[model samples]
Target: MARFEEIGTATIPGDGTRLRLLQRNDEFSIKVAGTTGELMNSRLHGSEDALATLACDRIASQPEARVLIGGLGMGFTLAAALSALPQDARVTVAELVPEVEAWNRGPLGSAAGYPLHDARASVHIGDVAELLREGKGSWDAILLDVDNGPEGMTRKENNWLYSPAGISAAQRSLSSDGVLAYWSAGPEHAFTERLRRAGLSVEPVTVRALRPGKGARHVIWLAW
Candidate 1:
């Protein structure tokens, strides 16, 4: 077996948790120092892409659609959104960890085709929740693949994102007919109910982590 080589490490800004980047042969993965396990893997990003694709497909006809992406993990979601959206569409990617963004621009860029360099994509090194609060009725679609589904695995603050208040903020951030998408490791019925309570219709989709019917099942919630 080929040993995994440690590429680099970064500290999560607020909690001081260390995130280690590792590469095994041609594959790359991100893992936290503590109990949360692997954050993401370069080879498994089907659900992430689906999160953006499903939402972008819904709003593809909207002229000059503005999309907000929460989390820039592996840039799969951003790349998929750019591919699905029209030339006039714009995408804003909010990444909490600065090192993650650096990784995407450096070692991991090729894995997702260097999405950050795209003219229509903008990278924000901050919390997506804050961005949602500030951008009122600004986004045509909001795709959130942050922190292992609706549950917060990396940061405690992420819990607010799935809460009633957070769902409300996400709802307000979208334009009428806009969609809000969420990616999770598994299903969360309570989270689905919360979205309904926020006045948005919800659709739960189970997608494989890899294409062609391979890998574990992941869930994507589409709300509008």
Candidate 2:
């Protein structure tokens, strides 16, 4: 077995939790200490890309579309969105941890094709919830892969992102035909119901972790 080498570590702002960046040969992974374990693996990003592709595909025809992406895991979601969106479109990524953004620029940048440097993409080093609250009907689509799922792993505050109040905030942040997408490690029936109760139609999708159909199954919820 190939031994994983610890390349770097960053302390998550606010909560002080530690995130460790590990690598084995060409593969990279982000693991949260004392929490949800491995947050993401570079080799397994199919679902993450799907999270963006699924939502962006729905609004691809809209010119000058605006997209808000929560979490910057390995930049897979951001990279996928950039590929699917037009040159006039814009993408804003709100990452709760500053280190995560830095890692994307340093270690993980090549794996995701240096998406942060794209002209259409911008990164905000803050909670996505705050961005959602401040923006009103300002986005054509919102993609969330923050935490492990609706339930948070590193930060307790992330729980609100999947709560009823969080759903309402996300709804207000979207345009009339905007879609809100979520990526989860597993199914969350309760979370789907919450979206439905919030007055948005929900579409649940299951995708593989690796492209070409491999790895564990992940779920994505598209609500509008």
Candidate 3:
């Protein structure tokens, strides 16, 4: 096992605290200042691989369709979605943290091969919540990996995106038969109900990053 090396450090704007990024080959982690919230390599909870799989599976059916991916997180989800879709598909990724996006297009791009910079990709440096509130439709698929899950990893305010109003906004942003998939660290029955209540046909898919070698399972909520 390789050890993590410090890549770069930055302080969250407005917030006085700082955070450091670490990398061990293709795996990466983040250490939050004055906090124990150190995200480990694409496993042990903050698994970017799992997020990618969940997002990709939901948009596999729509060729030449428009897809919106919330959160760039390591660019895993965006890259995976691009790989699953046809050449004609377009992916719009909305990321709140500009630094994360820069890290990917720079040092971390090698891990995922700079997929977000691909011709089919459009990067939105903004909040996913605001995007939802804009009432933009015509998207064939919308993948939300914004928080650690619907329950959130870092911010409690993210919980609103899992709320009834947020889900409704997501539904409105989708095409008639469009799919909406959310990646959560754990299951949330209330969120599932919210999806259905928002008029989407919902299904829960359980998956793992490693077939037999890895521990723990993650659930993906697929709503269409």
Candidate 4:
């Protein structure tokens, strides 16, 4: 078996502990406590690209739009979102952990070529949920790729982002025609219902990005 190498470490804000970032060949993994999880599976690819593409595709009609992306995981989504939008678009990225933000700004940036350097990118080092509560009708699109999904999660507080109240807050934050998109590891019918129950037009789209040639399945839920 290939040995996993220690890439670096970062502490989760307010959690008062540290998490380990690891690498096994091309795969990037994170471990909270003793359990290991892949932050970006080189074999499966990261799901961030799917969420970004879905949201950008929905907001392409707007000439100068504002986009809010939750989570700055390896910057795959940020890179994808930047590529999908017009130069006039502005993107505000909210990340919960300050250390995670630092990682992206430093070493990880080198790995990904620092996509946040784009003129349109702004990084907010705080909880995305609090950012969502600032006001109503603020963003043209909100793409959430913070966790695994509504059903399977890495953190407890993240569950609020997918709950009935969280969906309602998201609806309020969206412009009249704004789109809210989420990337899940797999299909989540209950979450789709919650979006509809929140009075947004919901659609499910699956994407893939696996092997160099083959593709991986990515499930996206979009709400307006």
Candidate 5:
């Protein structure tokens, strides 16, 4: 077995929390400084890919579709979205952590094929919520893979994105027929209901962390 090697560290903006990056052969993992498990792993990104494809597929044929992606972890979702959209489509990704974006542009990019360099992709170095609040009807699809979903997440601030107001903000950020997708480590019934209460239809999808039939299940909520 290959041992993990510490490669780098980054500090989260708001509360100054730290994230550590480790490499084990070709695999990379990002973990909160004092946490037990990884926040992201390059090899286990099935759900992350699904978070983009499922939403992007819905708007692939829309002429010049606009997409907003939150949390650029390893660029898996961004890469997946770019692959599913039309050539003229525009995709904007917002990543709260500056270092996270830097990591994506560095050697860490190989895991997800460096989607940032794609012609249709744009990067935002601020919170996704800011875009949701400011960019009304700006996207044909919005995909969020921030923090750890809606429950017991490490970042308390991310909770707003799952709140009733947050749900409303997300809805307003999208075009009338647009779709919004959220990625989580597991399913959160309350969050699903909140989406329902917001009057947007929601579908909870279970996806594997690794390849099909090989890893733990993660949840993706698609609402429109």
Candidate 6:
């Protein structure tokens, strides 16, 4: 049996909480310090990949599409988004933790095919909300995989990103016909309705951790 070895650590800005990067042989995982469950893993990124693909699919026709990803995670979502979009599409990923970005540029890079290496992909080492607030009608699509979805686990500050004002900001940050997508650890009916109350159309899609039907079920809300 291979034991997971801690390779690196990073502190969440607002909460001062730590996120640890672990590796067991060829596989990698990220977990909150002192947590048992993996926040993200190299092997179980199916839903993560789907989050970007689903959102990118909606805007595939735009040759120079501008996509903003809320979390870097393992770079799976960014890579998937890059793969689904046209060559000219621009993708920017906002990762709150600087160490996470470094991991993606280091040993953790290979797990998601070193997405940061892509020329069209860039990174913002700050809160994704900052960009949303300033980027009115700037992005064609916004995919948020931040903090375990609407019902955040790691950081309480992340709650605002799912709040009414946050949803409105995301709505306003989009170009006409822009789509917003979210990835959750589980179903969140309340969040879905919250989007509707904010005057946006929402579509909730269910996907698996490993594939279309091979692992635990997860929810992805695609709203516009």
For all predicted structures, in order, the TM-scores are 0.96, 0.96, 0.86, 0.89, 0.97, 0.98
lDDT per model, in order? Answer: 0.89, 0.91, 0.75, 0.79, 0.91, 0.93
Q: Flag regions of model 6 displaced more than 4 Å.
A: none
Can you write out model 3's per-residue Cα lDDT over 1-224, one digit (the tens) per residue? 88889897765443444667788886777777566566434444334455555556656676678888888866777877787788888889998767878888888776667887799998898788888888778788888877678876566667888988888888888887677888876677888888887777888876654443465576778888
Candidate 2 residues 39-125, lDDT tens each?
Answer: 888989999999999999999899899999999979999999999999999999999788788888987798999999999999998
Ranking by TM-score: 6, 5, 1, 2, 4, 3
What's model 6's overall lDDT?
0.93
Preferred candidate (TM-score higher): 5 or 6: 6
lDDT of 6 by residue, 1-224 (tens): 99999999999997889989999998999998987998988999999989999999999998699999999999999999999999999999999999999999999999999989999999999999999888579899999999888878998888989999899999999999899998998998899999999998999999999988889999999999
Please state every model's RMSD to the true fold in angstroms.
1.3, 1.4, 2.7, 2.4, 1.1, 0.8
Candidate 1 residue spans exceeding 4 A from truth = 34-36
For residues 99-188, write the lDDT of model 4, one tens digit per residue. 667777766665556888899999998889997877578899999988888963567788889998888888889888899999887888
Best by lDDT: 6
Per-residue alpha-carbon lDDT of candidate 1 for residues 1-224, written as tens digits (9 for 90 to 100): 99878998999888998989888877889898764467888999888888888899999999999999999988999999999999999999999889889999998888899999999999999999998887589899999888887778888899888998888888888898899999999999999988888877889999999874888899999998
2 against 4, candidate with superior TM-score: 2
Flag clash pairs in model 2: none
Candidate 4 vs candidate 5, lDDT winner:
5
